[model samples]
Target: MQTTGISYSETSVRGRSRPSSFRQRFKHSASWLKGVAVALTLGSLLSGCGVVNHMIYKTTGDVMQGFSRDHTIPYLMASGDLAMGCAMSEATAPLLMSFGRVTNEPDQLAVMLYLSAGGCAEEQGREHELAALAAMYERKGNAAEDAIIRQKRAYSLAAKRYLKGWQHHNTYYGEPGTGECPDFDDDMDEFIYFAGLLAGLQALNSEIQSTSSIGVPKNVGSVVARASSCLESDKWWGAPMALKATVWAMIPGAQPEGEDAFERLAMTDRMGDEAGVRLSHVFHAIAATNKGDEAMVKSVVRQHAESLKEQPANEDWAFVDAMATNMIIAISDRLWVENTGHRTPLGRLGTFWDDQKAEVETMDLDGLL
Candidate 1:
């Protein structure tokens, strides 16, 4: 007998069909710091750069250093937000490998995508910091050359990391030994597109932040092409499933032509769509984008904050929302910070910690469900 709900695996909806079994089927499918002694030894090594003996950790290591180490790792492991934290860390694994860290998690490939998304965030943050860095250099006129070099280095880092993220993502998980990703799962596609969106945003952010503007990175083009391919095939199902695709649709250069556009995309199923007022805010945030809708954005963000407070144990959804919320909040915060220099506590939290707070918050879900 056919299950009552609309099948998640189906590409398109005829009208109002029951939700799919795959939603629950795949739903079932569902990182460590060094020791203190190891910490002391590494700290001494990281203190200096010029010496060959200098202990250079990975790009992640360096960035992580600026935050509160004790709290960061634990925070990332929390529930509902675990996938995002894993994704963020996995993205930087390649760079971290250069520093001699090793990761062999069963879900390494999936984690890689999430981590890459996180890395994209890091790259943008660095770009935003560049304008400030350049101004500082100008004031210290004596070190103008040094400032230029630093900016170049920063740009290169963002570009390089972005490119690497693109490489791992392009395989479509088709790479041998990565796991069996025959075709693409709708849920999987949801996460993949999220990563791609983050990548595209990073590319745009780089251009916006740079002293000399460059055209969008090739990865942006690749991502857009892939997203178009997904839509043309009608590869996703339901509202939540469609949200990622809809988000991609909004990307500046995603598709040259499309019917319905925002209205159609907004109509798709959204997870937690029935969760009442809590979800209204979430949906509002998702829907408010690119419309110069500041009021909607703030409303959604505040609603999300309220939801998190009520359901401290909302590990599964919390983790999911963490990534979603962080992306919206991060971009929103950057714009406000860059243009107005005014920041809310959450925005400020992101700027100072590079999404660590969000990651740490997820850690609380570690053993929950």
Candidate 2:
């Protein structure tokens, strides 16, 4: 038969042309491969973007942390404004603390910041407590009850925040009394270490006052008492010894043989007066209060008042002197409220309700103002 011979490439069977299956398969595979390549490129870009963002965040954190520690802290320490310092600390803590998320954790700064904030809350609690006691003394039962609630709430917050500070301190320096003290970088470093110890002890005391189960370690006081020896007490204006002695007074059997807490406190009292930093007076007064020696507490307050007039606060460390003065005023206010149902008069810190008439003492109001 004379049938037309169709070429194999173009041949059709059953009235339909057959396409090249291999060529179509190859084209589909190439298209799929192109999509995969695009996806990989996009993934790489996204990953690189994440890396860049992290680097920026980390660098910013470093700068902010460094500036805050080096500049902000020094400036605050030099200024004699406790209320302003407290407000700044409370307001800026969360902002500064957020930096830790994008970079290395700022445990050292955290120790100081939380300690300051806790102190603020503790001060508020103290005011409320004084008010409650005054109300009770005056027979205002409902007001006394309300003040008690506010005082406990403030104390609970202080306890929690102070405990957080202690935790960060432990993270930065290792747990106190667990091992040898770290080699501190500078005076400020050592000061921060001491502050951390104070924070730990404050955590314990605040928790007790709050009457809450805040998980403050029972041994924190003992640990801090031992750790106080790590610092140069003389350079720190007797604060370390004051801390240790206060611990001895508070904790039964904490005092060692041949070591009288009161003698140490007396020595610290002189050191602080000479240094124009009377933080030791606060410690001495606290010990006296714990022993229920009201006269001694008042005596410490009187001594601090007289010292302020005898010599001006150290210009280089005005903030510390101011802090000590503020604490002493708080004690005086408590005494005043308890007995006379009022805070210490605006300028009458050293005087009391039953004091014999004497020449008024003058003081710079840097601490109060």
Candidate 3:
């Protein structure tokens, strides 16, 4: 037979015959190997030097910005927890600033970075102010003077940082460079816009606290009032309410008819509790202190302390929570220092009133007798 010269298996795989299944499998395996090789080569090329880390930071920052814009920010605003929000911004400052340094583009991330840095500077300014108070209480002549000088430097630093943030916001938003008020469309936009406003207000506050005269426009209150009306009272967790109340308390004849400042301040507590953030209470406490209303200040502080015990700051917003606690603790510390010549006792920041030993009145009266 003619098939005697060829094996049956070889003859079966001759011209026009299907290839063996093993051969097909091997071909597929080879193709897959080539594909994997190409992928690895491309990956190596893309991951060269700082490219990977830069891309990672960029992507992460973008995701975080989106998260903050959509979820975290709205929740924080509605909860009146801007302290935590500020803390969030502050925590991401280094990453954001580093990104800004690498790129010259003025994107939202850049604006946020500047704002966060500005907020941190403002907080540091407040810290310096507290140190000044502490030094003044110490009754050390040159020490108080040195503290005052440091406080002034901090205030100046805060003003510069805030101005930079405002300028960045204005530039990115296509607004006037003179720090003129800008408009916003949605809640996120409004929140960012308000941050610029707060930055300006902080600068003014620092200047005022330092007893230095800056060229802030006299019509700043009118601008703030106009912008305050744009904020949705329900969505913003009574931030507008607290701000208006503060304005009324600070400025002469600013309170509207039939609207009491203290009552408006009280309303913030209710709204703040519903939003799970009570930063408005801090604002109210500050106003009360400025007004020399010791009773109101004590009541506000007590309420803040009790609220903290009942509900601690959310872990997701840990930085913000810490900031809120720190702010209130600072207020308490000031009160303690003014009264007892010391700071709030260890681990007793929010619960300063609970410790009888720390009370100024409890100090040994027998020694005086």
Per-model TM values vs. the true structure: 0.43, 0.85, 0.65
Clash counts per candidate, in order, are 32, 0, 1
Model 2 bad stretches (over 4 Å): 1-44, 357-369
Model 3, range 43-159, lDDT digits (tens) per residue? Answer: 888778468778777776666656655775556534545556667667865655565544444355445555556666666666665676777777766776776777777677666
Best by TM-score: 2
- The TM-score between candidate 3 and the true structure equals 0.65
Give the lDDT of residue 361 in candidate 2.
92
lDDT of 1: 0.45
lDDT of 3: 0.66
TM-score of 2: 0.85
Better of 1 and 2 by lDDT: 2
User: What is the lDDT of every predicted structure here?
Assistant: 0.45, 0.91, 0.66
- Model 3 residue 80 CA deviation (Å) reads 14
Q: Which wins on TM-score, candidate 1 or candidate 3?
A: 3
How many clashes does the backbone of model 3 have?
1
